[model samples]
Target: MTFSIVARDGDAFGVAVASRFLAVGSVVPNARIGVGAVATQAFARVSLRHELLDALAGGESVETALEQALAADPLREQRQVGLVGCHGARSSTGADCMDWAGGLAGESGDVAYAIQGNILTGPEVVRAMEEAWLTSAGQPLPRRLLGALLAGDAAGGDRRGRQSAALYAVCPGAGYDECGVLADLRVDDHPQAARELARLVELSELYFGGPEDVESLRGDLAEEVQELLDHVGVQGDSVAEALTAWAGEVNLETRLTPAGIDRRVLEELRRTAGR
Candidate 1:
């Protein structure tokens, strides 16, 4: 009833999952910056997420952590899990899991990934995901992960159909307010959960994403940008103050830069002011 991948891209770790079950995100995905990521499903042992992450943080290999996690569980044959860490990637599909269940793991350079699914349409589903992930080199981690999920969906996702989907990624001190999370977006219940999840990811990028490559504001440019903020009803005594207020209003405080405003933020201010 579920499919998931846990992967490492550079110093970041990410997980993407889809399932016929409701609220799969709450149970399937977990990640920590500088540690690793894990997905537990198909009679998921939710506790394994914490245990596996703990093991990885303590310098255990992905394979070792997985073995320990399974050894500690009496109902191992009913649980499915995939893990990726600095050491590598590993996954397991319990024998007692529903038909059409399996997992795969692979690594290239510093990037490692694992794909697993149970009650899926066929092995082709996971294979397509692996192919997509491998082919998406040089792209952002979230986009590559989402591409894999979409490929699984195209190959025939959860034979039971879609009800929920989630995307999670983490980097050191990359979360909101510098909390160490990168992206955590979910479509808890959607007919086309993967597609909806993609949309939510875009919105998340706008509000929570980091600054992009664009020109910064200063001196005269800063004053002109401030004039736009004032035109948009953002009140402040100075340009920096006004832009900061506007950024807070639009939930884009994270994208503001001390050197000047982020290009995306400036564009948004223009758009909102025009409206």
Candidate 2:
């Protein structure tokens, strides 16, 4: 049906997907934090997703982890799977299909990945996947994973045609944080879903505010900080509340400067203005 791997190397998370049919997103995406890997495919094993995450979170190796899991299922051969950890160790499995099938597993400097697909020759798909993975450079893990999938697609992917795609990555931080977003994008149907997903991911990087956003924190009338306070409607005895609200709007670093606006200062200004 579809094949791909979700993996992490330390703080970086990655996802890769490809298929002959349209809309491969649901069957071909996988990811975990402290865990190893997860594989969801035709006759997709939904439980395996969480189970793999549980095993990884418990500090199980990709090998021992998947072993105990597959042991519980007799139809393991008909399934495809792969897992890698921050240490670069890995494991993979593929089964005989009515049609052609193929896959590969490998390690690389604290990072590893597995790739598999059906309705295609095994070596050709794996070869294209490996080559694409090696040639990609300086990009994030998501990009690298997508590159691998694209290579397989070019080499004759699922044999059904193309449709949907997806991407996911995890890192530390809350949802509102710029650096947050462990699992990112999903494009369920389209001719170029992978490319579209990559574009959105890049656009997100552009608009997401971070420490550098301090440069945009200036107030109007050369008193942008004051504008922030006024916008928040803090005056007189309410100056403390206003300053608190303003601090939330502008960077605390710029607001707390020696020339920074603070609660006491806002109160003084409020009294002078007789507001």
Candidate 3:
């Protein structure tokens, strides 16, 4: 009834999941900035998600962390889990999990990633997920993880149908506030959860993205923004102040750069100002 991908991209780690269950994000996926990521589904032992990350944070390898976590759970046989740590990746499908249940992963390597599912339409689900993950090498970490989840969904994920999905990840100093939170988005309940998850990922990138395209507020750029603000009916004494006020109105203040604006913001202003 669930499929997920857990992966480590450089110093970042994340989980992307979709399931027939309601609010799967609140339970199935877990990750921390400095540790690793874990997805526990099947019977879905939520505690194991934390346990696995805790063990990894305590310096255990992905293999040992998974082994110990499941060993401590009485219903481990009913559980399915995928984990990725600093050194390796591990996946487990319990002997008693429903048919078409299993995982794909490499226990030790530079690429720490795992794909797993249970009650899936067929092995094709995980196969498609693994293929997407392996082939999406140059993309951003969060998008790469979501790519795999979307592939699983496209290949007939969770034979039971979809209700919820999530994309959670962390990296050291990548967040808007420089706090390492890359993304934490979820479709708690949606008919097309995986696709919805993808949409949320795109929105996250727009709102929480960095200042790569921001230009210094001077010369032609400043003049362009002043004209745009006037065209958009945004009023202020200074162009930057007016733009910041407009950004606040549109809930885009997080996208503000140092005395400048993101190019995407300029694009939006242009769209509205008809420039």
User: lDDT per prediction?
Assistant: 0.89, 0.59, 0.88
Tens-place lDDT digits, model 2, residues 1-275: 66565555556666766554455556655565544555566555767777876777787766777788888877777776665656544434546543566566777666667666666645586678878876775656666777777777677666666666676665555123534454466767777665676676654433332232122223452364455456556543343345545545543322333333444334434453454
In model 3, how large is the Cα lDDT of residue 3?
Answer: 96
- TM-score of each model, in listed order: 0.91, 0.68, 0.92
Ranking of candidates on TM-score, top first: 3, 1, 2
Question: Residues 8-119, candidate 1, lDDT per residue (tens digit)?
Answer: 9998899999999999999999998889999999999888899999999998888888998898788999989999998789989999999789999998788999999999
C-alpha root-mean-square deviation, each candidate: 2.1, 8.7, 2.0
Q: What is the lDDT of candidate 1?
A: 0.89
Q: Compare candidates 2 and 3 on lDDT and give the better one.
A: 3
Q: Across residues 1-275, which tens digit of lDDT does each residue of candidate 3 receive?
A: 89999998888889999999999999899988878889989888878877888888899888888888888888999889999888888889999999889999863354579899999999999999999998898788999999999999999999989999999999998877787889999899899999988888988887788755888889998998998899889999888889989988976777887758798888878987887
Best by TM-score: 3
